[model samples]
Target: MPSSSPSAGFRSGLTASLPITLGYLPIAFSFGVAATRAGLGAAEAVFLSLVMYAGASQFLALALIGTGAPLAVSAVTLIAMNLRHVLYGPALLKQAGADARKKHAWAWAFGLTDEVFGTTLGVLARGQHRFSERFMFGIGLGAYASWVMGTALGAFAGGGALEGFPTLDAALGFMLPALFLALLLSVLRRAQLPLIAVAIGTTALVSWLVSPVAGIFSGMVAGAAIGMIRAPRATKGNTA
Candidate 1:
């Protein structure tokens, strides 16, 4: 296929993110409601959704805030929670074209939310290596639009709805972990992947017994260590 213009690529990227927007609407609405209950004003709730955009981290932070956790504690926890994004860069680099690399890297960095990453990766895997910027933008803009609208609705209406529907809130809280588990399983199809998963699980178990922040960091470190140790060695015998 011929190369696409920047605008077209952006549009394509945005359009490709449509499925993500659908999923994010409800999730973002839940976030808006949670943020409101956590003492954030409607405007602040909307702002957080737009700026942070990290669904799991934002939800966790809002939960902490509602519990009267210190700002530092919440901030640290959110950072720890998002450490997994660091692993996504190298994987994406392999798929993006030279012209799209810089812009895509930026988008991947900023739009590293779970749904966007999944959708973009699927698109790249399908041989649509040089997607229009419009595609990416469409997804981002669609998601952003849904999030803001959901947050506004949730903030304004969530409290009254919650009074009669307690189960809804609890269910919404469970979505993030469930989504992460699904994503983990998708990537853990090979034997080599299990070692890293085991390391992460072990670290998290240890951390839960001690400190949340320490546990998350320890899990990441453990995963990285296992991946490095398992990497194939380059020997003279194997050199061409």
Candidate 2:
């Protein structure tokens, strides 16, 4: 039932991505604003977005360029920043069947970002939505379109736009984490509550004790291990 798509499946896909679309607009706008402030022309800003389409990395690259970093160093830094994105794909791949994992599906892998990954993971965890290419397309396309449009708007608005709406800036600041938490809560199930608590507790504790990076990676690894260990028990309980 969870994997089944009804008559309005495409619409469902689009609907599922609404939160992400909303979350993307201001941040992408911020990127455009940043690009311009970094001395990039509007054309260059839009072009950078179209070519790179990487959210944080785009900002970092622009900053690096502004600082007169060498091309190779800039490239390597941007690439390194994006390496964590590799962690997003395998989980999604396992959820996809061979046919669904066709070349076309893999081709759009570039669209996968932290926000999209979390939303998709949430959807999969809920086990109530079809994770088809069309669905994934909606998730990716909606976020992509919003991001590009927002960038264009920001480019046109320039830096003053963000300043004009101070609230927008604040909202954009918290968009990613807010969206991540919202997605997590939306997918939270009673059965998974304990594990989620463990993951959250561990992440918070580690982040407080160490660095944000250490906390993030440790939380992920620890949560995954716990989930795996509990799966067999869950299966046995279900069978009984």
- My TM-score estimates for the predictions, one after another, are 0.70, 0.79
Question: How many steric clashes between backbone atoms does each model show?
Answer: 20, 0
Clashing pairs in 2: none
lDDT of 2 by residue, 140-211 (tens): 888888889989998888867778778768978998788888977776655566567777888899989986
lDDT of 2 at 223: 72
lDDT by residue for model 1 over 20-84, one digit each (tens)? 66567667887777787778888888888778878767878777878899888888878878887
Q: Which of the numbered candidates is closest to the native, going by highest lDDT?
A: 2
Q: Which regions of candidate 2 fall more than 4 Å away from where they truly are?
A: 1-7, 96-100, 189-219, 225-231, 234-240
lDDT scores of the candidates, listed in order? 0.66, 0.75
